[model samples]
Target chain A: MRKTVLVVEDEFLIAMDLKLLLERHGWWVLGPAASVEEALALMDEELPAVAILDVTLRDGTVSLVAEALRAEDIPFVVASAYDKPEHVGGEILAGAPNVGKPTDQRLLLAALEQAIYRMNGTSLPLDP
Target chain B: MNLEDLYRLMRNGHVQAQGIIDTVPEPLLVLDQNLCVQTASRSFFSTFKVDRDETIGQHLYELGDRQWDIPELRLLLEDVIPKSKAVVDYEVEHDFPGLGRRTMLVSAHRLFHPDNISRSLLLSIVDATKRREHEAEKDVLLGELRHRMRNLLALVQAMARQTTAAGRSGEEYRDAFLGRFNALVQAHDVAFSHNGAADLQQVVERTVAPYSGSPAGVIVEPGPTVPLASGQIMSLSLILHELATNAIKYGALSVATGQVRLRWEIEEASAPRLRLVWQESGGPPVAAPASSGFGTQLIEFAAKRELGGRVELNYAPAGLMVEIVAPLASVS
Candidate 1:
């Protein structure tokens, strides 16, 4: 079964590109929604297997959606321009994996896999 | 010496000390152990804009309309200096009666006399307001630069990702991506040259300059001087680049005699608006494409989405004409 990944990003072009990239990796992509309200509304309809969140939205910080995702025990990663945890919020950034903005595709995928592996309690394969 | 002679010598020493304090350049004040001003320098009265009569006999806190009454400064002078005998470069920002807010660096030392057992404090005030303001402004500019650099990187990343999808082969992808990236860099260079402002006439000429094969190939019309903001400059640069690229490859710039006329004017609407035109003439015939390509989409998207403008392209039989209309407030 293909697991669904939710992408919460405000930038229109980048969001569309991320959706296409994630779909190419054989994962079902959910809403590349632009805001907290939209993300929560999508989540209400169906729970995704994983979520990729941008720290800042068009209106404000996405800590509210992050908190809700955490409450649901969903695995997620923060893709942000800021490096410091306090740049978003210390408490929210503490547990989630963070990949800085303008990150390479490989890094994004590896982070996604790491999140999924943690959620599934499966060990990553060792390279010989 | 007898008691009378000793009293005369002490009075003379006090007068000389007061003269020396008044001559010092930095604002200086001598305060007794009780924190009452014993004397003040001429610099102090001028700096704080207060008279000697109001300062000398008054408590240090109450002097110059209670301007010297800063809580941290009081703690440093009375409590810290009493224990340590001196405090150096203690900063206090305060607003005096005539002077607005100013940052003052206070350095105080405990002065003790050989004959007299009483202790007095010599306080020096150095104004650091200008230096502090310059440093703060520098910090803000540095932060803004860092932020812009990161955003540019993110934009490049997305551009690279999209360009890859435009082609099947790595070589093709590399070519397309470099073309787009160089266009973006050119826009940045123009923005930098103007220091976050660009003139409308200059923008059009510069963007179309490369496509002009001869001196008369591209004609730029005179228009009212309008300054564009940095963001608007970047978007307009990209739009002009796409249009010029198309012209060079398929429109006016392809032929030796083909011509492109660029002009703009300020339209007085409900709110003032900028109306620009890119009209190509003497080009080998023109026809609308079956579907909009990336370049067309890019121009339309930039004009509509980024600049909050309207873009119209007329693929007439004679030549291609593009008109972009945007609110002046939105562009600038």
Candidate 2:
């Protein structure tokens, strides 16, 4: 199955930018969700191989959503301008990966793949 | 008395007759029919700081050694003072003692002491330096007030921005943002107090102090002291403001146990550059943001364009860490 990535973002331009970047990198981009409710709904309907979460969404922290994905065994990476982790809670992401804001395409892709491998122990095809 | 009698008595110095002219505070002088400065009042000698005895025998031209004198004084007293029928005053550069040279108002009144033949002129002079000095001081004060007002306005604008941004976050976020904004404006005021030459260490220390007190338990320690240019100082201050705001709402400072380590050092490799590291730990696992916001955009803009620097923001398991590198020459 083709690997899918979920992109949750509020800004229209940022969402489009990420979507295009992911597509150019050959990963199937699921969505550029603008709000927490929308991202949560999408998470229920679709199961992405890697979820890229922006800590501060339009309405809520993606931390809860990341927790839900953790329960479901779906891996996600957090990205924010905030200099601290666990924005939603102080739950040290045991093996989770984080990406900083305005991140370069290569760095973001690395974080995504790393989170994916950590969640499933290399179940998906590895892209070195 | 008749014209002849008036002249005889005036020249002879009758005590009551000379009292009126000599008692006047105005520096009054008497010119004989030839306009020769003759037998002037005591005021004439004292007011001009003249050797009273030396000038007693001289003509108008030979009065007190005038610094800025007009040879036309006799003409003015003879022609203008009589025809005008009123006190006639004109500006002259007076040569006076103790006061080297000055602008003065010389007024002359043509009078005949109860007799037409005895022609005498009463001349008075007043100094005008104090007025000019007062006006100059007023202009300087106005300029200083204008500068202070502009700085105050900038501070108010920053406060407004902080409030609106914090309003988007929770109470904890609001307090943190407010605290940071206050620090920025306060630092600006202090810097401007010394005309924008504030010590760089004082500015940075205040900038990072608030973050150390956040709910996230972040610890901010200032690095080695270095001087920064005024513009660079302001840019760095804003950068810290934006970073602190973000950390309070969504980063390490937001959590109760998150910790942040801030340190800066001067690198003396090929070029002298300053490197700063912001490390966050004891917080939740880190990840890339789903979307970049204004805070993210500002970081890049200030670091790159304003400060001419490079920044790397990494989302790590321990938390989010940031690295900033800028040239040392940018200090203004």
| Best-matching candidate per DockQ | 1
lDDT of 1 by residue, B39-89 (tens): 989999888778888787789888766877888788887678989878899
Name the runs in model 1 displaced over 4 angstroms.
Answer: A1-98, A101-105, A112-128, B1-16, B23-26, B32-36, B43-79, B82-85, B91-105, B112-119, B125-138, B160-178, B189-202, B214-233, B246-332
Tens digit of per-residue lDDT, candidate 1, span A32-76: 877788899999999987899887775678888888888898889
TM-score of only chain B in every candidate structure: 0.67, 0.63
Q: Candidate 2 on B202-296: residue-level lDDT in tens?
A: 66666777666656554556577777756566667766767776766677777788777777888987878888788877767778889775457
DockQ, candidate 2, vs. native dimer:
0.01
Candidates in order have lDDT scores of: 0.81, 0.67
Displacement of residue B230 (Cα, Å) in model 2 is 3.2
The model with the greatest TM-score is 1
Go through the candidates in order and give the clash count of each: 0, 20
What does candidate 1 score on TM?
0.63
Which residue runs does candidate 2 get wrong by more than 4 Å? A1-128, B1-134, B151-181, B193-195, B214-216, B285-298
Ten consecutive residues with minimal summed lDDT in candidate 1 chain A? A119-128
